[model samples]
Target: MPQQYGTGMSHTYSTTSSSQPPMGTGTGKKHDGYPTYRPIGTGGTVGTIPNSMTESSKPVYKPTVTYAQTSRATVEPKSSSSPGQMYSKTRSGPSSKPTHTGDCKTPGGLPGLSKTQQILLSDTRADAINNVLTKNEHFKFSFGNKRTGGPGKGGEVVPANRKTFPALTGTGLGMAVVFLGPCGFNTPHVHPRAAELGIVTEGTIVSSMIPENGVNVHNADGTAPREILNTLHQYDATIFFQGAVHSQFNPGCGNATFVAALSAEDFGTGQVAQELFGARNNAAVADVFGDAIDGADVDKLRGAISNNVALGVEQCLKRCNINKRK
Candidate 1:
């Protein structure tokens, strides 16, 4: 891959040449286009994925239509397909108003919009854009600040998705800057609506994925656990297929940062263990264990699951000297 796509790589890859090339070789980025089913390593860099499609190129998300102001706005019946069509068909064409085009194209903010598009955008979208320009807010339904390494615990995730950044409504793209503290774990979760391409920018991350079970001829029983994807370091990239339960953990004693780009505007997350145990169904939880668990111990499990970020390999936490926050 380095030889084919990355002449700038420190040690260029080759069939005849060694994986480590001569020391004086030209150096820059890695473009290791790896496979998904095995090591799950991409060894990627900028311009890596070829001809990637934008949001508009994807299946347009058609949300359930429920309008409190349907009649008030003369909206088309509750059967409108796309959210864009729902909002746009009711309005006229583009406004003559000047918009925010690359710093107004002049001084005094003269030609720029005081706000986002008036005619083309709904009020909901305008407010979302304004907040993004002016404030530091959170993505939708962050796990009460605890799951992200807790308050002042150093890990953080800044996400830009449909609910958080409305400007990307039809863009078919969402991303997050994931910062993980020592032994910090981004829990096993599924993005139901989108596939994610993630690149670790700092530190080492141990990533794993449990694919949806089916008839795998090699491992037909499905009792065995899926293998760890890889221990990815700087510039290493990986892909999490849609609806695959995957996780990234900081294995070192310091910190790690990664960028995850999803091919959806509203890529929903379902944290597996937390969602399963945090629900209000204790009897069902025990039934999964064939009622082997005592009712009292079930409560304890729920309490522990409540602190999502506190969950990680015990050995890793001990090695990192990271104390679990409450």
Candidate 2:
């Protein structure tokens, strides 16, 4: 006899005497030595094994497993008064936000974390929204020093990353704080990876940009084929797309400051004015700009721009009709 275990029931097969002889034998005599087998039920029965197969050649019956049984094998057994009784099982999952249940670990479940990692791992949507009052990176890290090259130019940048401002972890963003003294300028520069959105917090500035598409492809007047220029004042905002050559100048007598947010954490800079005009010698500068610009003009421009003082402030002030200090 053999037994088979199915999803919800069991099946059995056994040898029994047959009144009729085997299929080819015409003699209608009972055969009990090698008995034939039949399923007990007409409906809802497992398929019978073929009679042609020898008893030794047939595959053995095996039990079919149910979902509940499979689940129980791996899961910890629940204790109860009766062994047959089961309690509902549950498993803990990763947190919806960064959280530590008194134990420091990343969302990735690694331990032995740094203070910066710990803070970042505890961030949540609710906590991030309240950053203006708590752990505000700009106010805490950048606002106080107020370093400047001169009256017209200096900028403090918060390159928010896991290392710099851990609270911004998982958020791909950063900021630049530009402060211009009356008649100060932030020289022509490009953020290779970031597009910038800036708001003027005080005074006025002339914002200018030559798009990357127009860098080598320029008009005959030595300007980019396409350019953007705007006069921004207190509370005025502007956007400079990624990889564009741009500059800002304070045209007002009063000091100016603007806060800019960048699209990426590591926004790199290339200052075009310094690289092109502030070279140590004339030959390098002329080679950089090519034969289109005269060698004499390159030297002349280099002398004018090499100073720590910003070059465009006086011209900006004059055009805006703001006085340039004598």
Candidate 3:
């Protein structure tokens, strides 16, 4: 006999029958000594394993950590000590008076004077010197004094008769004065580094200065030179600029005097005048003659004046339309 279980059915057989030959050979059997089979669509029954038999029976989750926001504190720098404290520490101590020494620490120190004494001494010395020089007549004469007058028309010049100072000696800076005698005329001349200041002392006089070219009066054919340009004239109380080629003639019939103050002690003729005149003459003669002046003609009339003088005079006279005098 065999027992069978399936779908709420149970059977027990005690004897074998021919119709069911053997259990293994039975047909249309639902169970074969194992669990019964059920298709998913049939909905007869469903089965599953217990929770204890599966590996994921209990789940695990790890804990996470979060950080809090924070800010860093700022630091301040230390302060320095006060100026008074620093100075006192460096100097060692505080004293009311400064130490004094008989000899001054600076170069050229007041040899015999303290600070106050030195000031007093210097003032006294200056005052004494000024008094002595101002009171002395000789000192007054040595230096120049001022004068006044009026300027004349047509470039008339007044002469100034000044006492001649001692000629400058040695090579250093030198100063001198010249007095133009009444109705005295100072010939045209140039000075180097000596600016002249003229002061009128008496009657009205006319002063005239001519450019080097302005004096050209000769022609290429050996005629007398004529005035090439207008003259520069100044009246009394007027100062003339120096360093230019110029001449002054006293037109006053009466005695007239003026004082001329010059930069240099000695008055010397300058080369600019000589060159300007020489060049002017040469150029004028050459242009008219169609060639350079020969030595014979140059010596006979032109004299030994520089070539520059000839050129300058020629140019000036030609431009001014001045005719050569016979």
Q: Give the top-scoring candidate (TM-score).
A: 1
Ranking by lDDT: 2, 1, 3
* Backbone collisions counted per model: 2, 2, 40
Q: Which of the two, 2 or 3, has more TM-score?
A: 2
Tens-place lDDT per residue, model 2, 1-326, is 11224432322221222111222222223234435523222212233446787876653322222222222223333333332232222323454564544323243455676535554544574543353224454325544354434322232333444455555555678777777655555656788888999999888777877676635544666653455778888899999999887777666656678888888766777767556664445664443232221112223334423222233454555555554322
TM-score of each: 0.45, 0.45, 0.27
Candidate 1 has a TM-score of 0.45
Runs in model 1 lying further than 4 Å from the true structure: 1-154, 215-225, 279-312, 323-326
Colliding residue pairs in candidate 1: 8-28, 55-172
Candidate 1 C-alpha lDDT tens digits along 56-117? 44222222222221223232233222223322222234555645544432222334433223
RMSD of 1: 31.9
Error of 2 at 293 (Å): 25
Query: Per-residue CA lDDT of candidate 3, range 1-326, in tens?
Result: 22223332223211121121223322333234533332211212433323464444421112112121213221211222222111001112345455545443312343653322333333354432342222444233333343222121112222221223211222223333333333233434566556666656655444444433444556677744342222223334444445655433333334445556666545454433234456446655333122221112222223433343334334433443433332
227 in model 3: Cα distance from truth in Å?
9.4
